[model samples]
Target chain A: MNSMGLALAILGASISALLAGIGSAKGVGLVGEAAAGVVSVDPDKFSKVLVLQLLPGTQGLYGLLTAILMLSRIGVIGGNAVELSTAQGLMFLGASLPIAIVGLFSGIAQGRSAAAGVGITARKPEHNGKAIIMAAMVETYAILALLVSILLIYNIAI
Target chain B: MGTQYASAVAVVRTMENSLFTQSDLERLINARDRKESETLINSKNAGTLPEVWEMLRTFAPDSKELEIILYRNDFHNLKAVLKAMVSGREPDSYIIQPSNIKNDTLKEAFRTKDMDVLPDYIRETATQAYELITTTLDGQLMDSLIDTACMKAMQESAEKSGNDFMRKYVNLITVCADIKTAYRCSKMNKNRDFLEISICGSPELDKESIIRATLGGTENLLSFLGNTIYAELSGLLKENPAEFEKRCDDMLIELAETSRLQAFGIEPLISYYIAKEAEIKNIRIISVCRECGADKVTITERLRKLYV
Candidate 1:
């Protein structure tokens, strides 16, 4: 492993994080807007809708963790900075692909879910807790993607 | 035929046949001793209580069936009240039953969206419930839409594969929904235009019988429906409704068991969700009983057999 390879791995990890972040940002934005509208009418509902809107932000956090792990793998944190060969760099890149793609799409879908939750809360507020819990359950898959990315970066030696 | 399809049908059929007989339901429900009633209810898995209640509701309207429905209703009422209280709305006037709403309370709650004016309990539960609702956006249509989609999917699955299991499953479910709705509409006949929603499923009885069975038991709808079904239910109220609902549950449980015997694991899964819902029902029941100071023996006796 050389500095060039390590540099490539760093780039790959950054790209994955950037992609997931973009998705999460967009999703959270969409849900936040709808939640804001709902809150305008029912100001007391701030806590519930806010929590729901925040859920999509988890992907971004997961992506950031993955990027950090990728950097650490290159010995970027310790005294000696290692590098990766082209093959090793490509492997790291490929490993991050799954999370990047899944994170992007699920984030948007979850936003729509947030909107629906908003409507339900507005109509039958009593059912809101169970409703949000169900939404959170859907967010689990996205977090799983982050986990896989972290695990992949951890295993890489670049 | 594909082995998978054939097996599924065989399992469902086996379950359909083996459900609890009328006598079995009576045995559990009509126990002479308090111990016997408590034993029947206590022995059940608390979780399966809701689905058990649903199964009972799907069965034909009868006295025994009504008791199970009432037991289930009691849980729902408690949940609704609690939920309403948390939402900052006085639950005292909220409609606790699905088809029934407390006309006055509903009007009051629906009129204003202010949380400050509501009682502390209503505010807390409502806020919690509101949060949950905002989070599960896609699930907004889950309750009513899923029922429709489930029927459609079952019908399609049945037609393409010649699978009677899905057919039977769909039939039973459809009948259940129809009866529930019809009973609802009949009760709302007082303000028929405002209360009636679209009716879509079976149990295929005339409008009169459906109204007769569901109207009397549904609380708070009496003033609206006038003097309908009240006389009949009051006369036979104690034993029949509970017995009938137990039979329905027995049917579903039997259906699931039959599928298990036939190695159809999925059948049990269906029962599992239903039973899960039942467990929630039981929890609410015990909580409500505790809150309302209902006699322990009476509350215990009303509980259904557990599924899982």
Candidate 2:
């Protein structure tokens, strides 16, 4: 039984969740602060700014999904634990890197875009869709990273 | 770039929508009577300058950079207090609102002769101006000294904050003040001593050159200004001081417009204050013109540029 391999796989899963969660937390918090400011001035704009605030939150979900899939693929869930070689554990770690790194950065980047979008919505509520589209454009990279992470997790030889 | 004051900037953007537009000013100018104009202005729900200042302070309390915006008012209050002390008149009537220093604090500092009670930016100037006014009893001289000190303080603080927007703001203010002072001094035939003390030189308009040109008379001063980047203003200064004043204010609005593109930072917050100030100024002009029964063309010419 390679405990070190299981430990490595667990470490990879933890890293994916930890880094991406931090990014989303930071991104969401930034937008929340800006949205609260607008709402404080004009309460009617709450719904518009709320949408902007939620834009940066997707990366955290991607990270959680990646971690769950990795844990399940390695049989760490369902009350079953599979013995993995050191190379296999390392491969699992490698698979998590795309989402871990990309999710972390894209979350913050998307948050800034969304926060700026919050300003647009605050000023011109009629153009709220433009702001949403601009912020959503940053999500494409995070989606690509999540796809790659899932593919690697599923295809890795046990 | 890193975004500072993200929340404050957004709030300012929201507030920007409430500011007066050009057409609003036109309607204000054409209002049938003072009552109508007042009603139109009140309906806009544009907050007072003090209210705007309080809101900004709530958002960016720690920003020393934003404090520079009120230095002019602070210095004006200082002048008022000193003049009141000299004339034995109450300063309350003349003291301006939205000042960085409280009126009571300024009065108390002067009453007790404890300059320490004043903010560090104005402490030395207050002390020096107090001493100069009491001894010489020269109100104009005291005013020049305080005005020069105000410009210098604004420049130093803006440079220390390393904010380009503030630096340019201070520069524009200094240039306009120096040019106005030189024009006035040249007209009065003030000596070199007065010119040297009154003109706070800017990078664009050198103090020594201004003094020399003024000594040569208003013609030389106007000629010197004509060659500078502010050449367009030279014609306005020559024909009408009122137009020159309007041009100076319009230039400030033009500068504030540049900050409108900025999404994040204290620049937007500062520009909002500028916009609000212009809106108030426009309201004041319309009220006064309506009271004086000034024609639309005259009132329209005097109205400063709108931010929106």
Candidate 3:
């Protein structure tokens, strides 16, 4: 119960959620500020800008999902209770780092790209698809990071 | 590319679809009558000249960029007031009352002869121009004083604003004005002293060399112009002075075209404002020509490039 491994695992999971969530929040907020400008002049564009506003939000969900998976793996969410060694805990923390770091940076980069994409739609609403595509391109690195985090966590011995 | 301008740029881009196109200008050019042309123009924007000016005012956020644009109008009003002071009566013409310096302030300054009421930038030029006109009754001398001041104000404001696009704009404006002055002075057979008083330029242009070349006459001036970026202008100046004048407007429109593709920064807003101004100028030219039964060639010659 007093295992340092459990503490490290929890800390790692918490960071995975915290950093990614913060990054997505900032990214979404940036797009929202830009969207507000267009919407002020043309309120008809609310739906289009709203779509763009949500693009950066995916990172937060990815973070939450990774955190949940890690929590479950660590027996914190109704699983076989096994106290972990410090090395095991540190390994879990290391496994969580991919998503925590990459998700944070990629989410922000995605948000900026999406904000710029929102500008395209604001100017040419018919080209919203292209704008969406442009923003979505930034999601690749984030998805790769998510996969690495999941793969590493899944393969780590308990 | 500042984050603050993101939204402003977006709104401007959305508004770009509403701009008059080159084909739209052609339609105006080929319109059978003035009424048809006016109908075509009103259909697009649905506003008079004043409303168009209003859009130009709001399109730019209230920043140093907007101030730079508005300064042209401010100095033009200064010219109007200074000219009226000598005329002993205000002309019933539309004077551009800028945001910083209002029409009332301009009129009051003219009436009171009070430098205190005027903005510090223009106070000296206004005083100098007023004294020159009153003492010698030289309208041209007064105009040169004001013109030099206007150019100086433009150069300072553009430089101080620290916008690269604006700095380029200032250079284009300064070089064009210098060329026009040199051309006019050469045509008049004026000397170095007159060129010193009349020609104002930016660091981008070598005004002294230009003045010296201009001292040698139109051929030397043309040879000097041939060596600069304005080499194309020399041929136009030789072929037709009117067409040469159009190059300045075209230069602005060309630069604005680059802004049309831009999705970020204050440039889109700046370009849109200039584009709208060009649109208005073209429309006015077409309308007046159609009303007067002037030829299409005359109207087309004066028409500026379209933003769209």
Candidate 4:
């Protein structure tokens, strides 16, 4: 029963959720502020700006998914916690790093992009799809990071 | 770091859509009568200058940078109050709104001889101008002093704010004003002392050089201006003073256009204010021209550039 190893793995899961969630929180909050400004002027714009506001939220969910998968893979969720070596614990931490780091940055960056998109939507509602597409472009890296994190989590030897 | 004012910028962008477009201005210019022009303008629902100023204040209440935009108006009001005090007349009619200093505050400052009531930017100028006007009874001198002080305040505040957009704004305003003052002073055969007092120099146009050029006369001043980056303005000044004034305003609109590409920060807010000012100016021009029964070409030529 390598307690240190299990602790390290749990620490890894926490970092993934914590860092990515922080990023998403900041991102979502920034866009929300901008969206609220537009909505204040034109309440009819709620739906369009709301869509832009939601763009930065995906990183947080990806982080949560990574944490849950990592936890399940280590048998922590099913009440059968595996005795992992220090090396195995380090491997789990490494696996979470991609999403933890990428999600943290991409969320904020995407938030900025989406916030600018909100401006476009505010000015020209008809061109909202263009704004959405521009903001969505930043999501590709977050998605890739999520994919890498998931693959790493699933393949890590218990 | 410059991405500050995200929400404010967003609101400005939304408001930008409501600004009068060029075509709108054309229609406004060609409106059959003053009543029709007023109707066209009213239909735009573009908020008044005071309303726009209030909205901007609400959004960026803490922005010292935005306050610089009103220095000209504040100084103008200060001049009005001082003149009214000298002439034993009420200043209310001449005072403009959307000023940083309230009308009552200005009047109180003059009545109580307490400059402290005014903002630091104008406090000293108020005291000095009041003394100079009361003792010398030189309204023109007082005006030059106050106008120069306004330019100095604008430039100093813009420099302190470290905002390039504001710095450029102040520079353009100072240069245009100095050029105009020099041209007028040169035409009137103003002395070196007057030119020295009136022209608040900028990096682009030095105070000493402009004064010297004006001393050499209007030709020398125009030649001096011709060599500078603002050569086009010099030519316009020589050809048509009214056109020169229009071009000066158009240059500011050109500067405001640069801020349109900015996504965030106080620049966009400043840009919106400038755009709105131009729109209002265009409306005023059209109204006055229509009232004067000026021809369409005359009205269109006088119209300042539109932001949209």
Top-DockQ candidate index: 2
Q: Is candidate 1 or candidate 3 better by TM-score?
A: 3
Better by TM-score, candidate 3 or 2 = 2
| TM match of model 4 to true structure | 0.98
Residue range A39-146, candidate 1, lDDT tens digits: 654577778778878877877777777777776676766656675688887878877876787778777667656655654555456777865876677678887887
lDDT of candidate 1 vs native? 0.51
Question: Which residue window of length 10 is worst by lDDT in model 4 chain B?
Answer: B1-10
lDDT of 1 by residue, B8-59 (tens): 2222222232233334345543455657756755554332444433443342
Off by over 4 Å in 2: none
* CAPRI-style class, candidate 4: medium
Off by over 4 Å in 4: none
Per-residue accuracy of model 2 over B177-259 as CA lDDT, tens digit each: 99999999999999999988899999888899989988999999999999999888888999999999999999998999998
On residues A122-145, what C-alpha lDDT tens digit does candidate 4 reach at each position? 888999999999999999999999
**lDDT, candidates in the order shown:** 0.51, 0.91, 0.80, 0.91
Candidate 2, A30-112: lDDT as tens digits: 99989988988999999999998998899999999999999998888886989999998999999899999999999999999
Model 1 alpha-carbon miss at residue A51, Å: 0.9
- Candidate 3 C-alpha lDDT tens digits along B67-102: 676666777777777777778877337587434677
